[model samples]
Structure formats: C-alpha cells, structure tokens
Target: MTLAELTAAQRHRVIAGTFTDRVRATKSWDAAAPVAGWTARDVVRHLVEWFPGFLAGGAGIELPRGPGVDEDPVAAWQTHADAVQAVLDDPATPGRTFANPHIGELPLDQAVDRFYTTDVFMHTWDLARATGQDDRLDADYAELLVTGMEPMEELMRSSGQYGPRVPVPAGADAQTRLLGFIGRDPSWCPS
Candidate 1:
C-alpha cells in the first residue's frame, strides 16, 4: 500500500485505541502508564502537546491550538486528532517537503509515516498498558517498524528520542523485539 494509505490505516487504529484508552482514563487518570513516571492522563497529554507540531512541520499547515489535556483530555485529543486527520486527508500535502532534523528534507507523507504515524501506533500500546487495556501490539506491524527503524537506531537513540535498549529473549515475539529496540521493556508494568 502507499504511504498515505498505510498512514491512514494506522491513524484509524490510533483513533480506536485512543477511544478505548479514554474510557479507561475516565476510570483513573492517575493510573501509572507503562512509560516511566507518566500517568494515563499524561499518555493522552503527550499526544495532545506533540502531534500539532509534527503535523504542522510535515504538512506545512498552521493548526489552531486547542485545549490542553489538563483542561479536557478527551476534547484535547479529539481536536488534535481531527486536525491531524484533516492534514493527512489533504491531497496537496503528500508531495510537500518537511525538513526533519534527523532525516533532513523528506516528502510530507514520508515524514508523517516515519515520524508521527509510527509514534501513534507505539504510544497506543503505552496508553493501553497504562489503563489496564489490551497492550499486545500487532506482531506484523512491530516487525515492519523494526525493519524500518533498525538502520537508524543509533541516530534515534543519540537524539534522545528513545532510551537505552532493553534486552529481550532470543525467541521473543516481534512486538517484544520492537519494544526492546525502542528501549521499552516488554515486561514493564505499573507496580
């Protein structure tokens, strides 16, 4: 499938995942997420705060700022998600250039796929795990991400976007391997 098609599919999954997480977050926003020190509310907040910049930088479109998660987590996420979806849906956005610090100038669709799309997919797991929802990542998708990211692992780690690698068993599943590669422990849980 084309990058836009793939990203659209990923976006759908992210929206569904966020919906599920939001319901769980209502139960307990203070619940610890799989990510160190971040609560379930923080999981949604992170997306709210970061996605706009990524979409703006890649699509070259200015988006109006919306409510912070502290103000209204669900509305904040929905607003950002809708804005990002609008940008992704725009026919004129694909061929535009985005100057990324890590990858230099790249086509808008390519940048979104590499940077933002994958982030949504990965963080879906964090939100799910944080809120006692199903956190099992799709193994096929994990493998695809691993293949795309392995070559740039050093650069990504050095950029401080990812933490130190967590070792997994040799026979671990694709999701476990992918999590380890991204410096997340597959076995991590809130104590």
Candidate 2:
C-alpha cells in the first residue's frame, strides 16, 4: 500500500484504539502505562497535545489547542482527533509541502504518514496496556514499521524520539520485536 493509504489505515486503528482506551481509562486513568511513568490519561494527553502541532506544521494551517486530558480526557481526544481527521480528509493536504525537523521538507501527507500516523499507531499500544485492554499490536503493521525504521534507528534514537533498544527473545513475535526496537518491553505490566 502507498504511504497515504497506510496512514489512513493506521489513523483508523488509532481512532478505534483511542476510543477503546478512553472507555477503559474511566476505570483507571492513573494507572501506569507501558511507557514508564505515563498513565492512561497521559497517553491520550500526549497525543492531544502533540498532534495539532504536527497537523499545523504539515498543513500550514493554524490549529488551536484544545482541552487537556486533565480538563476532560474524552473531549480532549475527540476534539484533537476530529481536527486531525479534517486535515487528513482535505484534498489539498496531500499535495502540500511541509518541513519536518527530522525528514526536512516533504509532501504533507508523507510527513504526516512518517511522523504523526506512526506515532498514533505505536501509542495505541501504550494506551491499551495502560487501560488493561488487549495490547497485542497488529503483527503485519509492526513488522512493516520495524523494517522501515531499522535503517533510521540511529537518527531516531539520536533525536530522543526513542530510548535505547531493549533485548527481545530470539523467537519473539513481530509485535514484541517491534516494541523492543522502540525501547518498550513487551512483557511490561503495571505494578
């Protein structure tokens, strides 16, 4: 699939996962997620806080920040997701050019796919783990990400976007290996 198509699919997964995690978070918003100190609410909060800047930078459109998760987690996520979806839905977005610190200037859609979409997908796992939901990521998507990111590992790590790679079992599943590549231990659980 093209990167745009992949991004769209990934976004759908993110939306579904976010909504699912939102429901789950009502029970334990303060529980620690797999990403160390971040809680279930913080997982959504991080996305709500960061996605608009990414959309604005890629689409060259002003997007005001919305309520934070502390104010209202569900509302915060819904608002942010809707704004991002609108940008992704726009016909002009694909053709627009945008500059990214990591990849420099590229088509807006490509930048969104590379940076934002992948983040949402990966963080879906964090939200799920935090909320005690099914956190087994799609193996195919995980494999694709692992392959695509291996070459850029140094750059990504250098930028502090990822932590030191964790060791995975030799026969670990693709999702396990992928999580390990991005510095998350697949077996992690909240204490």
Candidate 3:
C-alpha cells in the first residue's frame, strides 16, 4: 500500500483509540485546566474544528465561509468533524493544493491522513496530559513518525514541521522522544 494509505489507516486507528481511551477513562468531564486555558474538552473541540480548516487547506475545497467560529464549542465541533469525516471517506473527493504551516505543498492524500492521524497521535499526548493518563503511546505510532520524519529531513528543519523542540527525558525510549519532538511535553500537566 502507499504511504498515504498506510498512514491513513494508522490515523484512523489512533483516532478510534483516542475516543475509546477517553470514553473508558471519563464518561464526561469538565475542562482539563481552568477557564483561562485549555480543557480536555477543548482539545477534542479543537480536533473537531481542525478537520475542516486543514482539509480545506489541503484539498483546496472551500466551505461557505461562516462567522469567525461558533460560540457554542460543542456544536461547532460536532458539525465540522462530521462533515470532515464524510468528505475524507470519499476517495473520489480531491484535496486541494495546500500551503501548509508545517509540511509545505502537502498532497491531498498525504495531507488527508497527515493532519487527521497526526492529530490522533498528538492528541493522545494531549489527552494523556489532560487526564493524567500517563502511559506512553504505542510503539507503532512512534515508528511511523520516526520513519516519516527521516525522509523529510529538510522539512523537519522548519520550526512548524515535525513538531516542537521540547526536550525528551534522556533515558526515555523512542515514543517518548517522538512525543517530545512533536510539541508535547511527556510530563505536561496543568500548571
């Protein structure tokens, strides 16, 4: 299978896994941090909104430009995520040319899974921090990122690409380091 296909499947698994893990851990909860900062709910909310924004950027499809954003966070998430998933499921649907913040002219298929799946993997880190679910991510996800980044060394050099420069624990394994590389603090918590 192509890299896009492989990454797409991996992304689905990660997204599914995240939902499952969160549902298992907390049936319902309030914000992760205080009103001033992001809550666990906010993270999911962002994931939901991100679908359309990046997809639009990637697929070159445009939605009816609405107001800045919906005031009700919950409704906003449900609407965008549902639409985003539907469009992505249709293979015939072509993603547009996107000038991405990280991966530059990311192709439609690559952009499709990259944005979604990477969110899957990264948000797992977010959820872990939000709820204090402190078990490291699975190795397969880390491998995808490791191998994924190696080929794109030039892109990885960009600040927006590959993730942030958070330091990994010296003795930590690949997964931890990968998470750290991608703007997540494995030891992150609400301050």
Model 3, span 45-130: residue lDDT tens: 65666566666665566544322333443444445544555555666544445567656785565576666766656666665566
After the best TM-score superposition of candidate 1, give how far the Cα of residue 106 lies from its true spot, in angstroms: 1.5
Clashing pairs in 2: none
Residue-level lDDT for 17 in candidate 3: 57
Superior candidate under TM-score, 1 versus 3: 1
Task: Summarize candidate 1's per-residue lDDT along 7-68 as a digit string, tens digits.
Answer: 55355445445554554456677889877889988977876777667666655578766787
Q: Candidate 1 — which residues are off by over 4 angstroms?
A: 1-26, 57-59
State each model's CA lDDT, in order: 0.73, 0.74, 0.58
Model 2 local distance difference test score: 0.74
Give the candidates in order of TM-score, highest first: 2, 1, 3
TM, every model? 0.86, 0.87, 0.65
Clash pairs (backbone) in predicted model 3:
32-39, 32-40, 59-95, 59-96, 60-96
